[model samples]
Target chain A: MGGSSGMTITTARLLRAVTLVVLLIFLFRPETFEPMLALLVANNAPAIYNQGSLLSLTISHLAIAIAATAAAALISVGFAILVTRDFGREFLPLSRSVANIGQTFPPVAVLALAVPIVGFGTKPTLIALFLYALLPIFENALTGLTGLAPTVREAARGVGMTGFQRLLRVELPLAFPVILTGIRLAFVISLGTATIGSTVAAPTLGEVIIAGLLSSNTAFVLQGGIIVAALAVLSYDGLTALERLTARRTGRVATAV
Target chain B: MIASPRHKVLPALDKLGVFIAIGLLATLGFAPLMVFRANRIVLGETVDIAQAMPPGPMVVLLASIGVAGVAALLKTSAMMRLIASLAAIAVLAWVVGVSASFLVEGADAVARASPASGFWLLFGIFALMATDALTRMDPKPSLRIGLVLLAGLALAAFLASGIWDDLSVMREYENRAGSFAREARRHLFLAFGSLFMAALAGIPLGILCHQVRAVRGPVLSVLNIMQTVPSIALFGLLIAPLSWLSTELPILRAIGVSGIGAAPAFIALFFYSLLPVVANTVTGLAGIPANVSEAATGMGMTERQRLFSVKLPLAFPVILTGIRIVLVQNIGLATIAALIGGGGFGVFVFQGVGQTAMDLVLLGALPTVTLAFAAAVIMDALVDIMRPSGVQKGSQ
Candidate 1:
């Protein structure tokens, strides 16, 4: 049984490697799959998107999602930490409600609203992404920090650890895996959402799909959809792996809330 | 550290309340309360709250907010804080409407007036403070539900009152009243219709997975992958296969199962809704204690009878939670359905974006947010109410 499970892991890794290679080929040399795409698209013309290289579009898409998720992580984690502490404990309900209510605003609506306030293009997209990504990370971080076992906390205190020292050295490490899961969810969400940023004239892969829709070209939409989906899936898998590794190291089973 | 008589003279302040009050004051003092636009599309010049309102009422309103702020800062009882915040919010709402009317008094018929940053910030700050007070007060669940209904009705009446007729959003609504109604219905159809389909399919699939353990892992993983596909991509991907089907089979086209419009959007939303419903159903069923199942069997209950009488009743709240999640999520996602010509509130959103008309964007966004929020609140209340009484402490 152990050997079979190990074999399954090997097969999974091999499948992942093949998927990565295919994704790279599709992004950099999409024409290699053109004959097949032509069969799917009904357009005899070049099935590959020509306005911008798929590689560049993928990079910009990753950049926007990464930058927004990073900023959201910093702010949300800091705010969560603050609210969990003694001085900021009064704000917990406010924080929880804010996070919950903010999420009820759809990502597309939020992005559209941002365009009017911040004006068009990448800034609005970034702002929307940052705001939309906030709730999960904040909620998860709060859960992780506050849900710590009382005995473990007391043990840290018994070791003569100061509040700050205990939080930094003990609580955070134990909570890291859960917090990472939140960041993972946030990142994947941002990656998917950043596609819509193209509507606001942000240079992202959604530009490809929207352009395709405008011209009734299936190839463009397919190209954009494939790359975006691949990136999201791959990144999600990588993050899940990282989460598992950290959970194992910390002697805690990471659970998604 | 000793309690001192001198300390009694000055009450310890509520820090968060003070922070929110400061935010309100700063917004009123600095930010523009409204914008006066010459027409629907152009960027408008901002009008300060004081400048936009008549002096007498403006001064009175400002004074009320100041009083509220002081009440917040003084560590007053929760009841006092709640009343103060509610009063302040009422004043702010009236002030905004009056200012909109004031700003548009002599402007051309085509000209528009809309609430600006100061108005939004003030309203948000006060509402937060009110909610905070309410949370601190910890009202009964029934009271909370009643308040939500009352607030919804008040908003409907407020809109119907025509006090906001001068606002740009109201102007947009006036122009598209017929289409707005159509789109609103379509949006509801897209959200609720897809949710209905998902529940129909998902509950059965969940039962299958729970009963046949062999299928559980594969089924969940596939659903997880479906979820990972970004919504836009999923919607986009559906177009090709669906369009081909519609073209290949004229009968499907007749039934309106096309690549674009509500069909793909419905299908995509249905797919998105499946994971939560199925997962929760499986969890809910599996979570039934083994002893309970044994007792049901010992009572001479058949498998079907055991499921209906014992297991499902216990799991209903959990399943409702999943439904709540799907409902809120579908409401939000329905906005994106408009991208595929699916026709929801997103039509106004994208059009407003294209035209650079902020009010039009607000026309779409505000409703979507409100609907999602209302759904969440109602669903949450339902979940709370439906929880089996014995499991109350364990559930939370």
Candidate 2:
């Protein structure tokens, strides 16, 4: 009876967390408010909802952000696995070197190199975001895997489980929490880097800022920057909530209530 | 660790593979030369082999082949050997062809040519070298080969372009070498200077925030807010305040300080660096075991003494790590400072893009990338040295 009640409590908490994230998303959707404000400021306020270009731009930016972040997560996890196996220790320094290179190479530089070949667009922007997000994802995955208690792994192996079986059933489940944290970090980074995409003619929130800069329009710049900041903050808060929910689900967090 | 007959046989095979790869590259590299020679006959123009050829790409290709071939020849699986050999051959050929064209035909020709061609050539070479190096017993040799190839490329460019004789900034403008050298030096200087200022301001503030709980929350939140603001907007925000300051203050105006230059640029970069340094410092200090501090206190050490001797010594490594992050971030952001006359490598990058001068952009960008990498390595080395032996032993 107590266990069932506890599960119900957890479910409610998870739902609340989801609601918060959704709220954040809606807040950053410029079509939801930006156009209405622009209209009101330009002249008299209209009662009708305006489905402006801002909606399409926001959707495309979000899609690019998600796709790039997902790709970064996969590559980082694979690299982390390679770093943890029998021959993995020997490659630790090499792995760190590569990850360091990825982080140290500025996204703008990547954009410059990519522009001539990939020719400007969301594709080049996606590549830059992926590379930019690699370090944190890779580091977190490696840290999570290595931080696992050896005894738990040994016990699983002792129970007649094959290495692969033990890895999937025991190690990965245990490491999921940390890996999720990495994903969260990568997601936030992708969101920020997507703005730089606007420079290469890839339409994103950065377009607004760049347009503002060129025209010296502080109102437009403020509108764009504020929306970007709102997006970053909201996304960060969403990730934190997700992290908390994951911890609770995984029985990693000790809740008083 | 002793080398056996197997090792000797492997190295020999690797050497043979390298030679074959280099040979292929040289042949491919000369393909464009052949095309140029044939075209000259049709146009009734004499083909000058010395003028028509670029040996740099060929040399780099040859070097790559030699290194990769030796790696393949080692007593490895047939699959490893085949990949290494093929990669070496492909890379060499591509490098030779591309570099030859780039040297003989020039920048405009390269730009007008197929976009995919140069990328594939460069990508193939980089990939092949990476694979060959990774498979080696000692990766150092492969890295050395890469460095040597880079050096050869640099030397070739210098010799071919006559850049050495006309190294003067004024001379470049007169000779149409463009503003590559002068712009590169300015950007490099800004990157280093911005990094230095960020460190000086950030570290002490980080330490203060770490020591005082009262200031930590507000300081951290402000820093976090600053980071979320995009670079362009941050630069824009500074113009108003800085312009106002210059107008009000006679001293600032007299020094040629304006809204759009170094002063505003530096402030923006420094602001951006605050969060990482402060957050890391607080986290590092907080992470120090409570028992250690208690023990120091029990020993009758003063608060300042305990902080300096015990807590700081223990937390120094993590603190350094945070500083490293701040320094690297500052370097990258400093480039964007050029948008507002911060006058770094970004000037060239933005200007090149604006003017469609890929060469000028590359000149601006490549060194910044190299400098950032070098800074990261130097910081990593410093962190390694400062780390206690106990921590090192435990991590391994």
Candidate 3:
């Protein structure tokens, strides 16, 4: 019986494995020479380099993103601490409710409402990104802090550590790895959301693509898209590396259980 | 009966302050009209007739009545209070009959003056104050109250300001109506369709990946890669191939296949949906205890039976949760599809942005957001239904 189950599993995996390879091959393959060439030309180094406006816009987007991420992290960790403490159980449902509501309010709607008051540009975009990134960060921090073995916390308390001291030395240190994972997720999401800021004319990689779409310039669109994708991938991978390094350095890899 | 004098006085003062704050906010909200007068402007001018045509004192009187109604309701059931407040405001609105005037004036003003004038600074401050007052009332304030207050304020402001006189606002709506409808239909179709497709493709793959260690590494990596692709860029990447196909295939060309519409939008959204669906499915399936499957096998069940009856039933909730995530994400991302003409509410959004018409944009966006919220609520209900009753009981 086990053997048959194993075979079924293997067959399924093999099918997916093959399909994935085929997809990659298709994606990377140059299907149309002219379009591809056009895409390259539109995204050529000189045009991008000369576009000071685009470059500054991109910088501003990143700056705002960083600020938003920082805010999300602080709020999430604070909420996480509150929820994980003994006094926090009463507030768990409240925290979940907040997160649920946050998720439901689409960032675009937030942007629309904010534009009239904030008067466009980076501030509204930052607020939207911050709200959008809240749930994941909060969830991860809560789960990370709570998922720690009770015994470890108990041991810290038994040693005469105060509540704050216990949290800093034990709970936080242990939760850092999981919290980092959440940060990584939030970072990736924020990167994508920042592109939406382009609609408000806040400038980012999205400007190139939006311009391309409006003008029907396929090359410009593709080139801009490629760079954005590269940036996402680079950031995702970079965060993963940072997470792993932190995990290793803190020796949480061994104590994770 | 033996309450301290200080405590009694404090409650009275608190109530008094609430009333005062509400009144002050309402007065300040209408203060913008003091600077401007109602006057007609020729079409194509920057100054809108709406700005020129201020509401008469009658409208202001009605608004004050509405505000009083709202304040009174604040002490009772927040939900009932909100409804009462809204009813008062709506009644006031009908009494004033300024909506038509506002629309006409707003259009003229937008045509004549820069569209930005319609968005006065006081309008925002008033909205913020009203929202703050509503939210601060309770530990968990009624969403209904908040909505009613916002709608009441918006209607009151528009009527009072006389910003709606211009026919251009209506004309803009009508001109974009066809495109907007088409885009809306396209977005709804793609958002739901892509999610449905993701489930069909993702669940089986997830089951397989969980069962086979060898397949896990590559499958996970692919899923990760999909997740890492920023949404706009993903759509950008899709345009080239889809466009090529449109040209290469006669059927596609005849169908009016284009690079910037539904096809590319659907494709990009579909690709994005896969990662969450697949990841959730795998995680859910993998989490099922080993002994449960072992017992099913020992009972002489076939592999298919084991999956359907044993594994799937057990993993159903987790699978649904993944679907929930996909659905919510799709609703939000569907807006981006508007960038490519996939339509839905995004048509109004982008057009409004381009024209700088905040009202028209709000009309489109408010519904989109409401739809998303409704969708989320429905999905949450589904998950609740799918959850095993015993598990539900245990969780509680």
Best by DockQ: 1
Give one digit per residue, the lDDT tens place, for model 1 in B301-334: 9999998899888878888889998999999999
**Which clashing pairs does model 2 show?**
B13-B73, B14-B69, B14-B70, B14-B73, B18-B69, B29-B96, B187-B345
TM-score of each model, in listed order: 0.95, 0.74, 0.71
Q: What CAPRI-style quality would you assign to candidate 2?
A: acceptable
- What C-alpha lDDT does candidate 2 achieve relative to the native structure? 0.63
By TM-score: ranked, best first: 1, 2, 3
For candidate 2, write residues A193-227 as lDDT tens digits. Answer: 78778777887877766665565555455655665
Q: How do the residues B192-255 of candidate 2 rate in per-residue lDDT, one tens digit apiece? A: 5655676677667877887876777667766776777777777766766788799999899999
TM-score of chain A of each: 0.94, 0.79, 0.78
> Per-candidate DockQ versus the true complex?
0.50, 0.28, 0.27
In model 1, which regions exceed 4 Å deviation?
Answer: A1-7, B1-6, B248-250, B390-396
Every candidate's CA RMSD: 2.6, 8.3, 8.4
Show where candidate 3 strays beyond 4 Å: A1-50, A53-61, A82-91, A152-160, A249-257, B1-180, B254-256, B390-396
Candidate 2 chain A minimal-lDDT segment of 10 residues = A42-51
